[model samples]
Target: MDKIFESIEEWMRNLLTGMVSSNLTNMFTDVNEKTGDIASQVGQTPQGWSGSIFSLIQNLSDSVIVPIAGMIITFVLCYELISMLTEKNNMHDIDTWMFFKYFFKMWVAVWFVSNAFTITMAIFDVGQNVVNRAAGVINQQTAINIDSVVTSMETAMESMEVGELIILALETLLASLCLKVISVFITVILYGRMIEIYLYSSIGAIPFATMSNREWGQIGSNYLRGLFALAFQGFFIMVCVGIYSVLVANIQVSDNVHTALLSVMAYTVILCFSLMKTANFSKSIFNAH
Candidate 1:
């Protein structure tokens, strides 16, 4: 019995280790591929392709992809809950097949936004002069002071004229708003298509399974309502973010404590508001259905 138990334990340990290692390997491979793609898009190569790819991927995943994924997941889960509640009320249809299709499309849209580093770079002009200076630095062809360049960029927000700052903020807001609008429209179309498919499939399976024209109209209305609610939530978050940016741009607190405290408070408030909005919106969507 003791020998058998010991062997079982050993087997379990190996199985667990293998599972973990496989997951880690897949994660690293994904990062490597994404980083290589980004590097190629940016027209630059790191010292060693593999090492640089890993580092770049790590940084991008940490700083951008993870947060975006979290937000998308949160939205998707909330939407699912909303669907469940509406289905419970028997107010509208809840087709799992349709839901899956819509969810998959939304996932694709979110992925595009998450991986949009090139779009961001183009919008912000982040590496234009930096690239030129870097080329010069590499070839020893120019005497550009790297430290001064860094300081200047950092200080630009502070020293910017009021009009210029406002314009910059507005531009950022517009770009984000445009992207979000496109995303929402895509989501709506995807959902609509899924619903059509579901209806057709049901009708084919059962001759009397077709919904009335009124029911179809109700579904359309409910979806549009949900879409608007989501858009409003996105707008609210963006406004908060804009305020945060302005605060960061204007405030030059030397004391770390003061900065840290204010930032924490601001972030906490934003988080609470966002959560409340998400929960309420989920309820609303469910009620609509």
Candidate 2:
């Protein structure tokens, strides 16, 4: 009877141990995959990230928005020319240089409207370059050392009673489920940012048309600042991931398996929160409304 009881206990222990190990393994895998993905996604320019969508947006912008921008540019230049002529002396003090200035401003306004897409893309290219450099620094360091986790976790599980191991197994399973939800949130942030970039780029010419007018230039200027904010928002996300990686790297799973797992989950939550805020933070810095 004692032999039978001992055998049953051993079987339960093994089952629970396997369950905990499997859960931990899956959780770590999710974290590492997300970390790697953020590095690559954040570094991609809009055109490089989704070429088909970007090409479609460009086509739409050229066909639809550019003509509207042309009319806006003409109206703004006419207003600007009138403003320039009248602002000096109500009509009597027109300098010869004023006409030259009006013509120069007209040329600039037309050029900006014509090449709005090019200018908008250039902003993202600069952001991509910055993020790529940061990515190289963080890519190798972000993966969780799951081997270390497995080694120490196995030894710790051996000393745990069957009932305790069962509870821990359930806990780890719950943690893993939480991680799956977090992963979805991360995916949303990445895809949503790309979609926003495409949307903003589509009407880029309209804002560029307003840039050369002294009275109305704030419209285009704020739009440009918003683009910069969107671009650098990716860089801020990379920084958040890099910080999370460093924090996770310092976690000594050998010290306490339960604490380490919970800490990892907590840090991942923090990472998601930080990534969500990057857009607003970047916009505030750029003063983009």
- Highest TM-score: give the candidate number: 2
lDDT of 1 by residue, 219-283 (tens): 43454344334323333333333343333334332233234224533543453354345425643
Candidate 1: RMSD over Cα atoms? 25.6
Candidate 2 lDDT over residue span 1-289, tens digit each: 9999999999998888888889988887777777778878988988889889989999999999999999999899888888887888898998899888788888888999999999999999999999998888887767778878777788888888887787788888878998898889998999999999999999999999999987689999999999999999988998898898888778886677778778878988998899999999999999999
Model 2 spans with C-alpha error above 4 angstroms: none
Candidate 1 TM-score, C-alpha based = 0.24
TM-scores across all candidates? 0.24, 0.96
- Name model 1 segments beyond 4 Å from true: 1-212, 255-269, 272-289
